[model samples]
Target: MNSLYHGSELCEVDADGNVAVPAFLEDAFAPETSPEIVVAKHQADDCLIGYGRAHLSTLAERAERRRVAEEERGEEARSHYRRMRGTFGLSERIKRDGRGLRIPPAMRHLGRIDDLALFVGAGDSFEIWNPQLALESDDEHFRALAEFRLRMRGTKTAGVH
Candidate 1:
């Protein structure tokens, strides 16, 4: 069975932008093959999404199928190109270093992450959020979780004096 990621962990992002993958999520990664995870900006959210390499394979397969289908229609595949760019093009395959997985500068800017990242599992994938931005999320669960965790960490959310 494929790995199912569920649970949340708060991690510190060091100066080099490395954030340790939570221990609970370690089993989901196939370290023997490659110690990498794909991090991408969530299309509709102000956060980053993460998944194992296997999920990247699945995405490639789906993209290929879409490409083939577009060819069969005897029409330009602009949609396919757009989708690919939005998905694969914007993603970064980051390897795990000694400290942890390094969040590339571009992705770091895209996700607005700094100092602290709150990892929340979303079944097949997980989310990387800047705890401060998470506090503004419309999703009550995420907002509350971020709030609770920040308090536990003795960190105060901005404008929350």
Candidate 2:
């Protein structure tokens, strides 16, 4: 149900490994018949994250601004850049059509995605996963969210005089 970046879709990959785009999502895409998509394997998990080229551009701009700001604070942003380069280097630009998308063989192998695929919404992008891995990741994601909230609260409390 997370529509921010992903839609709730359980699509089956046909023999050709093509996944059909859900009508709701397909209708929401830009007018361009084929948009560039960047598919990456999650560094910490067994899933793939897809980033529309448009989204990736915007993200890069935002990240650059943040990196400059971090630089002023004498904080190293190189690690973040390294992670991004690693992911983007492994990414392939695939044409997205109304039918859905064709997961390149390399990306599929990188994520261990075989037949059944699940698309889950991410804030700025969406993730693709095999059903079982998706389910396991959901549990992990939920648990991480809780711990993250607690960590934030602790940081805020400690900052207060």
Candidate 3:
């Protein structure tokens, strides 16, 4: 029987980046708990984005929209579109070899993934991040948000929109 997977799970990846999928998440990719997963680079940091066949189809649709949006745009927009395409174009599809989820070499290198891995759930999707990188990236985000909030508060007092 299959079930839905939710919540965040911190997991470890071997030197080869193959991670043992927790029982909770195992069913998330059910019928074949070990289907081939599509891996792409995370936009915010050196993290890998992974999803099963079902979710990847949805992502492909969104990517198509972004690709089409840049057709009549300038160089910068075109570059951004190209990057988006390349990220997905270069993505790797890894399958579970019965032992664990095999994180492909290309994705592992791109995301700087090593022994320590953090699997974070994002609703229907999930992110694979190197623990150290995730910590540093999260701290930077917090700092940036704090500074932006402070600036906004000051602007409010000055009647700035």
| TM-scores, one per candidate | 0.83, 0.70, 0.69
lDDT (tens digit, per residue) of candidate 1 on 111-156: 9999999998888888899999999989898788899889898997
Q: Per-residue lDDT of 1-161 in model 3, one digit per residue for the tens?
A: 32334654556678777789755556576665547777788776678877775666566677777666766554346666666665567688887666478888888898888875666655666677765566555577633433343354342212213
Ranking of models by TM-score: 1, 2, 3
- Model 3, stretches more than 4 Å misplaced? 1-5, 32-34, 70-77, 139-161
Greater-TM-score candidate between 1 and 2:
1
lDDT tens string, model 2, 55-122? 66675776678778888989888866876675668788887765778988988888777776666666
Candidate ordering by lDDT (highest first): 1, 2, 3
Model 3's number of clashes is 0
**Compared to the true structure, candidate 2 yields what TM-score?**
0.70
Model 3, 153: alpha-carbon shift in Å?
39
Local lDDT at 153 for model 3: 36
For candidate 1, the 10 contiguous residues with the lowest summed lDDT are 24-33
